[model samples]
Target: MDKIGFIGLGIMGRPMAKNLIKAGYAVVVCDVNQQAVEELRACGAESAATPAETAEKAGTFIVTMLPNSPQVREVTAGENGLLKGIRAGQIVVDMSSISPIASRELDALLREKGAEMLDAPVSGGQEKAEQGTLAIMVGGSAAAFEKARPILEKMGATVTLVGESGAGQITKLVNQMIVGINISAVAEGMAFAKKAGVEPRRVFEAIRKGLAGSQCLEDKAPRMFEGRYDPGFRINLHIKDLWNVLETSRAVSCSVPLSGQVIEMMIALANEGHETKDHGSLGLYYEKLNNVALKEIQK
Candidate 1:
């Protein structure tokens, strides 16, 4: 088993790293949150003070599950960086949902240093992360993908290598697009039903078994009716993803009117202080506009 160095021990990263350990790998972890570091250590993982330190000790391969492209770049571009400790044959696999263009750039950088890199982003929110059943989309050379397959399997139920560098991030963007659009439609439908004097719950049940049924509906519909805004995935992060969608669309000369509209609504929710709430809380916008609550929000 390869010694694994995992950086970023947040909601998703901690669970993923734990599963690697559970698979009988020697896993070392590092994070800015000392509490998170200690928690993983308590599970039999070693802790490191910095990315460089973790890379040095666990140089077989490193997995970064950070929040964004900027943080991923920051972790690899300096003295206290992953690349500093990466040897000629080491692999770098980033599981962050970030820009594909940036992923490609990082791939080139790692290759120049005689190492390999994979842009392997995941779907299935926090719940699935804890369950170790995420669907991972990988983009890298065939050899790199093959090398990372066993490691990826420990953290994800389905892992597919789609194409060359950046494909995984592009796939993740498509996922966010579909997810954002579905949540928005669900919110609007619930709001319209409530204001039209039909019970929102009943309306959900009726359509959910029809052509409108989806994983989004099954998972987020109840949360909508209950007005639960906890962060399974935050609205703020969705908004950031929409920004990426718009940028990617512009580059491809594709017009996505619906995604554009949803982004504005998400921005509206963010402006109203629901940015940190679950993306399902998108219903809050419609509730506010219609002067009705989908369900009584628990205080």
Candidate 2:
């Protein structure tokens, strides 16, 4: 296995990088969080101070799981950026959920430097990230996808090459749109169950195995029942993804009114300082509107 440079050590990135290390890859990590860097170092990973430094040290592959397009741009093209150190034949696999347009532009920039880029975003939230069972959707050259499959498989159970340049990020936008809308629907239904004086858990159990059941229902309904708003995936980050969805939709002449509504509800919750809370807090939005709490009502 080649030495891999992994950047961005936040909730998803940290565990994904650790899995690469566990798989016997010589990993070099870069992050602004010194504590996260030290923690990974303790796990036998090397550390780099900047994206450029990481690229220089890791040589063949550099992977970034950053927050958004701006962050990805800065790390790849700004001062001490990866473009400075990436060589011809080196590939940068960006696993961040960012704008598909931006992903294409960045790929072009890397090509100018004789390097290649792959837009490979992932799903399955923090739990699956820790378990190394994420579903990765990739968009890039077929050859590059083949070369990077083993490395991606270390962090994801399903790795697929979807299309070229920007398709992976576009597919992720579709994923987020469905997720955001489904979460809102779940929230509304559970709140309705509570207001109707039925135990939300009972309703969930009654409907979970029927055609109404879904992965979102399975993952988030329990969190709603328990009122656990811990960050499996932050409301703030989901908001970012939805907003990107809207922007991309506008560019391609598509309508997403449902996503727009969910974004509004999430923003309402964010204004109440629940931005950093789990996205399952969409349930809390219904709770507030209906003047009932899911946890308290269940009790």
Q: Which candidate is the best by lDDT?
A: 2
lDDT of 2 by residue, 105-177 (tens): 9999999988989999999888899999999999999999999999999999999999999999999999999
Backbone clashes for every candidate come to 0, 0
**What's the TM-score of each model vs. the native?**
0.93, 0.93
Per-model lDDT: 0.88, 0.93
Clashing pairs in 1: none
Off by over 4 Å in 2: 196-199, 296-299
Across 1-299, the per-residue lDDT of candidate 1 in tens digits comes to 78999999998999999989988999989898999999999999998888878878885689999998888887876568877777788788999888887788888888888887799999987888888899999999899889889999988999999999989988999899999999988988888988899988888888898999998899888997887889888998898878878877897899999999989998999999999998998888888989978984466
All candidates: CA RMSD (Å)? 2.2, 1.8
The stretch of ten residues in a row with the least summed lDDT in candidate 2 is 290-299
